[model samples]
Target: MLKIGSGAGFSGDRLEPAEVLLEHAELDYLVLECLAERTIALAQKEKFHEPEKGFDPHLEVRVRRLLPLLSNQKTRLITNMGAANPEAAATKIVEIAKELNISCKVAAVTGDDVFQVIETNHLLPNDNPQQVKKENLLSANVYLGAEALLPALETEADIIVTGRAADPSLFLAPQIHHFQWSMHDYEKLGKGTVVGHLLECGAQVSGGYFADPGKKEAADLADIGFPFAEIEEDEVVIKKVEGTGGVINLQTVKEQLLYEVHDPANYFTPDVTADFSKVEVKETGENQVQVTGGKGHERPDKLKVSIGYHAGFIGEGEISYAGANAEARAALAGSILEKRLSDKVPHLRIDYIGMSSLHRTSFGEHTPYEVRVRAAGHSDSEEVAALIGKETEALYTNGPAGGGGARKKITESIGVLSNYLSRDQVHPKLIIRSTDNETI
Candidate 1:
């Protein structure tokens, strides 16, 4: 049986559960899907400040803990934690291994960055729902497929660090390495792709995000165990480390299966076009669910690129009102703030918490004792954006009764721009480094 587990769902996921998986699951490979569309963009911003600090902040911590287990040779690690600087991350991992007195190999995969291509080709945005400007682009990364991972695996590296890659490709690439599966074998590739999707979110398949009070509730969710997939040539069973919190049943598996999956019949990736239309999920045992019937087709010719650019500054403020007529006071405060900052800030959003904030609630139907009024605006001028929050805070003493806990913040916004590129356009680069803190 081939076993793989997810260590992270995002950049800031808890580290202990992943540590538990590394110590117990006896995994064949562990994938850390730490990069998101916005994550790499922010990393690029960091790169501007310092020459070698764009990788995941937790990279050193994770490597230090995993180095001991990695020396055992049965398990290897792969991650997209090297978000903006794979080579730098590789160097750091090797240095940590040296400090731990363990010998291992680290491979950094590169060439996913399409920043120069965006400038040279003047490529237009692809499927951009927001119609973001291509001219303001900061980071442009092509989502590399599983095939780009083949060379690094061939190097027999204990750890592989990548930049921006299709989430499933991180797990599928290792499967391709272990099974020695041909890229043309779409059926098994599709099955492997399903395995990747199920485990990528780390805790999502283990009931971390699932809870409906009485209708659905998982066990001991506080200590949610990271998820692992026990895969065979044809069958895949999802499970987690023993004696941990969270449940792994049909409900959890069903939710994770459809996550971020827009089309059930055609899910495109660089390696294969997976069809989850006929996939089946059934409980095989306690905290275990079996997956089957995933199909695939020819790979897509073009790969999707995620581009991030400056979207101006965002300033926000919030004030809470309590006691008598709190809901009414909160509404009045929002209206007043809007009127004050109306012309200064062209785009503003105001919402009353515990009232009709998220959606339309019955007006005065369920009077609440407390409500928070939040106002935010976006603009190119820092001063203009900051005025919205200042005016919101001014509502504390200027108008309304019982308005307290006023807080304000301003942040530079980095927005995402989606685009496509020809498969032939982006190329993959590989760099192998040894455990002695030396690059090869």
Candidate 2:
């Protein structure tokens, strides 16, 4: 059985170390999906401070621990930890392996960073002049597909390191390399894609978000489990890693089926088309959910892409006030500021939202009043200066509430980022392992 597992954790310290989490759970292959817009920006910030830091600082630590586990030949890994510099990241892993005297090859797959190349080739549309910027381009990641990842896995490297590949590729690459699934094997590829989607979120498919129908209670989710996929040509099975603390029931499988799926019939990826609606999940045992009836279609020629850049100075400020009209006063304060700033900078857009008693029920119903106001905008530093100029007056307003402060323009930048089709007709190259440890 080819057991595929996904790892979960935020960019920072919010998540425990992978070694700590995977200590009990056993798996054949481990995949990490680590790309989000916020994460990319955070990675870029680290890159800015130390030019060597291209990927998340946390990933390097995780990989250092993951390598020794893989020396047993039972555990291999594919991770997007490569972030911006897959080659450099791979070199680091190889060094770690050498230190342990372990024989393992690190394959770095790249060619997905399309930020500079996109601009130089004029791949961005001219009509969207607002998006084309030279300075504010924060992070540029390409939505790579499985085709580019196959060669790296073919080398049978200990770990496949990559930048921002499509979320499904983490699951799909293993099937492509193991079964030698052809580029056009839509039937088998679709089954593999479904397996990938099933296990992509780690713990989600293991009942973190599922509701039980038999009992009027949630799954015993604490120490919640991560997903595992067992694949074959005629069928596939979904389960959780052994000794983990979650259930895999019919309800949980259904919930995972609906997560982020755009279309049921045409669930498309670069690998294969997954017919989600036709899928049937049956509880065959205590923790195993039998998966069958997955159908397929042809893959797309062009890969879908995701891009982001610096979008000026967008910031948020929050302050609490106590009074009966606290909510109203906060609203009025934001309104007054919006009108004043709009008059000052015609093109400025102000967004204010209340994040307090307005949405929560535990604010002691009626005895008190407090509002948390957050405002954000994208404009020049001069515009931010104009907005901050009026904060004192808003603070002193004789409005309904009393004793509140304003926070304005916490983050500022003038770069507008966007994405588009790369019309330059460049072939995305996939290199297995470079001896020089240099970027291609």
Candidate 3:
């Protein structure tokens, strides 16, 4: 059995749970997924100023902490921690390996950047041939598939870093090289992709974020354990560290299976088209569930590209009101802020945060002892954005009684626009710059 573990569900996940796996779990490969829909855009924004600052902020910490545990284990590390720059990340990993006096080869996979095509001809060649504009475009990256990572696996590299790879592709790549699974075998590849998808979110399927008060109870949630997939003869058993917190059941697994799925029958990827409509899942043991019945078709001809741009700014302010008629005071404060700053901004919004904030359409009933009135705006001008927060802060001194905890700020945001291009458009390759510089 080739055991693979999920070290992280997202970019800012808990570090301790992964550390526990590095210390105790017996595994072949440990995959860490830390990218999201707009995470790459945010990374691109950072890279705009400082060239080597776009990768995950926690890359060094994750690698440095896991080095000691790698001394006696066979688990090799795989992660898309290389957010915007894989070469820079690989350099940092080489430095860390030298610092710890550990000998390991690190490989970086690149060529996800589509700006190469846009910059030369100012237009794409396949499908979307519209003139590519360099005006507000921050980052243009093609979603590389599992096959793009095959060259790295064939090498003796201990650590593999990638940029802009599909979420499930990160987990499926290792299985292909280790199990000798054919890239054209859609059935096995599809089931493998399903296992990758189920385990991709780490604790999402292991009950970290699936617990309810009285309906579903998960024990030791405060110290929830990271999950792992045990694969043997084309079957997968999802389990977590023994004696750790969190529960894994049929419901938890089922919820995660359909978490981000738009359509099960036509789920498209560069590797294969997976169909999860009839995937059979059942609990086989404690914290262990068997999954099968995932079907697949031919690979897609095009790959999705995420194009990021600078989207204006958002300014927000929040203040609390407590005691008698708190809800009325909150309502009154919202009205006052709107009356003052209504015509000043483009997209001004007012809400009683504690009441009708979550579901904007639903006006909540039964007010409590306190409610927070929040006013916000989105604008291309920072001055206009800042006005929304400034007016709301005025309520602390000029409006409502017993209003406290006034807070205001402006946040820079990134906007993402995705489009599809042919698979031939993207050119992925492995850059072997392993740490051969031994300076202990």
Which candidate should be chosen as best, given TM-score against the real structure?
1
- Tens-digit per-residue lDDT, 1-440, candidate 2: 56676775234422432453355446667787776655665566667787767875677677666667666645778888878777667777777767777776778888777766666765554556665465555666566778878877767676788887777778888887778878787877777777777777766677665655676234566666666677776667786656656788787778887788888888867567767778888888888898887777886555544545555554444444556766666677667656655654445433333443345444554434456555444455545644543452455653335745654445645343445443244345555543334333
What is the lDDT of every predicted structure here?
Answer: 0.88, 0.65, 0.83
TM-score, cand. 3 vs. native? 0.94
- The superposed Cα distance between candidate 1 and the true structure at residue 427, in angstroms, equals 1.0
Q: Per-residue CA lDDT of candidate 1, range 52-98, in tens?
A: 88999999988887778756746889999999989889888888888
Instruction: lDDT for model 1, please.
Output: 0.88
Q: Tell me, by lDDT, which candidate is best.
A: 1
Give the higher-TM-score candidate: 2 or 3: 3
The parts of candidate 3 lying over 4 Å away from their true place are 118-134, 361-364, 437-440
Candidate 1, which segments miss by more than 4 Å at Cα?
A: 126-135, 360-364
Q: Would you list the clashing residue pairs of candidate 3?
A: none
**Distance (Å) between predicted and true CA of 70, model 3?**
2.7
For model 3, how does the per-residue alpha-carbon lDDT over 347-366 read when each residue is reduced to its tens digit?
Answer: 57888776778887455356
**Backbone collisions counted per model:** 1, 4, 0
The segments of candidate 2 whose C-alpha lies over 4 angstroms from its true place after superposition are: 9-25, 41-51, 99-103, 126-129, 134-140, 209-217, 344-370, 382-409, 412-440
